[model samples]
Structures are given as structure tokens and as C-alpha cells.
Target: MSFKQLLYILLFFFTVSAKGSFILIPMDETTQQNHLKAYGITYWALDKQYKISWLLNYRGGSFLLPDAQEIRKECQIRGVSFEVLSDGESNSILDEISSPSQNMEAVVLERTPKIAVYTPKGKQPWDDAVTLVLTYAEIPFTPVYDEEVLSDGLLLYDWLHLHHEDFTGQYGKFFGAYKNAPWYIEQKKNAEALAAKLGYGKVSESKLA
Candidate 1:
């Protein structure tokens, strides 16, 4: 059979036979091949309209997905580690999570959240590890700055990430050493301009406000 047809057939069988079963992708170091790829798989599943249960603090933040051959195939293709759990086993996991001793919790992901990163406009992914990982994993994020935040753009995103930012407005602690550096001078100028535009006397005031 053609690959497409075979995939459809396997999907049908998997959906029927694996009802109430789940695939768990643990984020522990045991998944050394590519722990990040597990997140990519979860994103892919979200794109496919699959609901995911994010098991926070469980096995180092794992994912629980309904059993599907397509998802399994994607995990294998991406080299993400996963395990299938029967209904009983899944319940046991929940039970353990409910116990007082565990720090586990769950969040249901019904849709892909809009992510925003607050960083300088001219900064590149190479300058920030979080941006690099998000870029490499094919995750989309909007880059926002002081202007955007002041304009209420922050309301548009479900998640926000900050990088290399000095909210204290001390110019990233470089004022005492690299104050004369061109890059530091530019950063200070930009921040001061923004602060002035926002009616603040100093960048630190604007940031703190």
C-alpha cells in the first residue's frame, strides 16, 4: 500500500484500539537524544488539533497525549522519547499527582498559545539562548519592546519571555565599566528616548512603572 493509505489505516486502528490510552514523553535527562524535540512534537500535535496535558513537575515536566500512530511516528522521526500508558496506568499517574507529597500538576492545552519575547529590536537569536532554542525548534514568537508593551501589545500574547533585559535600567550593569562602548551608548540612548517619550524622567522609572 502507498504510505498515505498505510498511515490512514494505522491511524484508524490506533484510534480504535488505543482509546483511553496515552503516550507520555518525559522531559527528564533520560531523553538525552533531544529533549527539546519532545516540545516540538507537542507543538506539532497542537497544530493537528490534538489536546495535550502538560504534566508540570511530573517526571521533570512531561506531556500526555492520546495514543495515535501519527503522533508515535512523529516522535520516532524526531527522536523524542515516549511511553504508552494504559487507562489504569494513566489514572495511577493522576492519583500520584493528587497525593500531598508530589509537586505534580496538570495543565490542559486546548490551543497553541501566542508567545511573545521582550527584547531589543536589533538583537538576534545568537545573542540569547532562549531565542536560539525557540528559533531552532521552529516555534514562532513575536518580538516586543518597550514601545509595544506601552501600546498594550502585551495583551495579545498568552505567554511572555524576557531576555538580556535590565528592568532596573542600570544599562545592564555596564555603566561602571563599558559606559563608553558604542553598543552600550546606543542601548542607553534608546532606553532614555523611550523613557522620555513615555513621560518618565528616567529609564529606571519607566521600567519600574
Candidate 2:
């Protein structure tokens, strides 16, 4: 082939490859390698002020992120499965989703939501499941208790997890059963201490506060 023809062919291939400039994080069960880390990565990107599009009902609600080198590195580090798509391919997918016949929508997410877990700060006999999951997923959340709630500290968070909580001020109805248990006694002691700190004479009053 002529030298000029060879140069033109190479440039054509380069242009085609350069068009693939978006990352598609697939959440479908068949393709997703790590479901938990995928969510964490999305949250991480959002926290970094990167705009992400949530593809609702599309390939199990995938996430579309800008094709940044750091994002690719993050996906690899977190073991999250993803695909690279050309601009044309990405637009085609969006168009398909925009069709009324398809049960899908693209939501642009720009804000990082602040999450709070409503639970005691004192050490407990057991760990909260929601907190465990959040920890594993690498998501950060604030731990709030009755004192914080009473003081209107909840206003600082966008989402709140009840975290195996109780109401009616009965302390999970533990008085009749296992009240003498060391863990139960310690738990009650902490509750009373918190109630006192909140200027309540009784735990029930603190709960109601």
C-alpha cells in the first residue's frame, strides 16, 4: 500500500477508537461481578462531584459515568464490572430508553446523599445489619441516637436508617426477660446515662423526647 493510504487507514482506526468515551457500569446479575462494590463506587463518584446517570430498568439499573481515567482505575480497584461505549452507542441506548414503550428512564444524579443510622453509640451485644452492609460497601454514614434526634440533629442527614430500633420506651421489652444479663444491664445503664445527658429523668421521657 502507498504510505499516504496507510496513514489514512491508521487515522481512521484511531478516530473510531477515540469515539468510545463513556463507561457503563452494568448491574445485571449475569454481568455484575461485585454488586456491593458497584454501589459503593457509584457513591464514591458522586461524592467526588462527578455526575452519574442511573439507567433505571436498563440492564438491571446500570450507571453511566464519564470516561475518566480515575474512574476506570476505581472500578478495577473495587472489582466492579463495566463496559466502554462509543458516543454513538451511548446515545443509541439513551434513545431506546427514552421510548415510551420501554420501561426505563435515565436519572441524572449530581448530589451525594448524606446518610444517618439511628442507633446507640455505645457498644452493643450485636452489630446492626444495615451498618455492617454499609461498612462493607464502603459507604459513610452518621450514627445518631435519641439525643441527637431530640436536638434536631437529624436535619443534617438526607437519609436515616432505623437500625433495629424500638419505641414505647420499654427498651425492647427486656425487663421481663434477661434483665440480669450483663449485656442487658450494660445497655440499660447506657440508656439511662444518655437520658440524663439529655436532661430527662427517665429513659421513657428521653425516648419520647
Candidate 3:
């Protein structure tokens, strides 16, 4: 899901002390396409130790959050679309979702999962979409290479994203067109160096291992 969608979900969680009404953050919009910013806000909420419920398949997976001034400010700052719902209205929506015919379900988010990316040490954000999103969302993640994986760094993370890497060792199928390019040559050299440093004769062998 986009970061904005995640943020909208996080903003739905309300503390018992909150006195305001419930807020509904809608995701089915085209004008204000700030989903990524919403994601950053969600990460911010997670950092503040808030719990959230994700209403799946409900109005494009809308979020039900306790209405708070801080959350309102955040929504405004991020340009996210939200509506305040009274207690009765909120409960009614929940009731509708509970109907057997509806495919909606609520998933409570308790904690943020640790994320990792399996990528080269020198790869840039322009080289990978996952990394770009993670960076934009301000989500913390570790970068692990073949050597780190071989040494069991995978145990440190609950989630992992592979970044433009080929386990089959074909160099990402770009060798035919850009084999002579400086960047390609540098990439090949880096791979070879890493493989040699890790006691592998070839980059493909190390990647496969």
C-alpha cells in the first residue's frame, strides 16, 4: 500500500483520553494525490507509539481514527482527505462492514515491523523504487548485501526488500545494451570485488550462494 494509505490508517487509532469524534480518512480520491505524504505521517504516528486499525475493502480501505487536533493538523499539512464521523455514524459503518455480504475486515496494527533491503552498498535511490519509498516515508531499514546475508544479518529484520539484485547472477539483464557504459563497468567491478572479498570466484556464484 502507499504511504498515504498507511498514514490514514494510523491516524484512525484514538486513545481513551481523546474526547473528539471519530475521523474517516478516505482513499478513493484522484485530485489530492498525496498518498506518499500520508505514509510519512503514519510512520510519524508509529514513532509516537500509537496503535491503528486498517479497515480493509471499506470505501477503498478507509481509516477510522480518533479525531484529534494533532491528527487534523497532520492531515491538513499532508493534504489528505478526511471526514469527521459521529459515534453513531461510526458504529453504523462498522455494522455495515460486519455484514456477511461485505468483504471488509479490520486489521489492527500493533507495532512497526523492522525492514531491511538486500542491495549493494553503493546503490542510489534512483536505482530502486522500494528504497525510494522507504526513504521518502522515513522508515528505518538496514541494507544487506550477499556477505551480510551469508553471515545471517537476515535475522535482524522481520521484512526484507530485494533491490534490483539478481540471484541468478545475470547482472540484471543490462549487460547486452550497457556493457560498455561507465556505470555498468563500475557495477561489474564492484560486484567482482565484493565476490572476491567474500571468498567467491565469481559474482554469480556469490549471489547464488
| For every candidate, C-alpha RMSD to the true structure in Å | 5.7, 3.0, 10.1
Q: What TM-score does structure 1 among the candidates reach?
A: 0.70
The whole-model lDDT of each prediction reads 0.86, 0.88, 0.77
| Worst 10-residue lDDT window, candidate 2 | 122-131
**Range of the 10 consecutive residues with the lowest summed lDDT in candidate 1:** 30-39
The alpha-carbon deviation from the true structure for residue 79 of candidate 1, after best TM-score superposition, in angstroms, is 2.8
Give the better candidate number (1 or 3) by lDDT: 1
Q: In angstroms, how far off is 148's CA in candidate 3? A: 2.2
lDDT of 2 by residue, 36-77 (tens): 889999999999999999999999999999888788899999
Residues 59-134, candidate 1: write the lDDT tens digits.
Answer: 8888999988899898888888898888889889888987889888888898888899988788888877888888
> Candidate 3 lDDT, tens digit per residue, 1-209?
99998887776664433444777776656533666666666656656676655678887777677767788788787777677777888889888888999999877666778888988888886678998888875667788888889999899889999766667777777999999999999998998998899999988889878
On TM-score, the leading prediction is 2
Ranking by lDDT: 2, 1, 3
- What is the alpha-carbon lDDT of model 2 when measured against the actual structure? 0.88
Comparing 1 and 3 on TM-score, the stronger one = 3
TM-score of each: 0.70, 0.88, 0.82
